[model samples]
Target: MRVVMSVQIKKNASIFEMTREATPKEIDDCKLVYCGHGFFDEADIQNNINKNLMD
Candidate 1:
């Protein structure tokens, strides 16, 4: 599965974002903030969106 990884490129800048493979744990944790294409939503991509949102 895949989902959008909304990460901030800078201060209040969320334009620069990407998609990534959605892990079961991620879904259970409600970490999928946004949704995107699977073409770029590779599992290899590191997802730090949830962490950033907490900050």
Candidate 2:
């Protein structure tokens, strides 16, 4: 089984996100996780666009 997870870091203005395709038990370890590929959607995309347009 595989699961997708997202982590957001407010201070850096960035998000630490990834996906892991592993068994149920493997996910519980908290350390035996694989880094997923590709970039996830930014949470502030719409907000930024709106702000820029308004400015």
Query: How do the predictions measure up, each by TM-score?
Result: 0.27, 0.23
Model 1 error, position 3 (Å): 12
| Per-residue lDDT of 49 in model 1 | 41
- State the lDDT of candidate 2 residue by residue for 1-55, as single tens digits: 3354766645424333445455667557654333334444444654553454454
- Candidate 1 lDDT at 18 equals 43
What is each predicted model's overall lDDT from 0 to 1? 0.47, 0.47
**Which ten-residue region of model 1 has the weakest summed lDDT?**
37-46
How much does candidate 2 score in TM-score?
Answer: 0.23
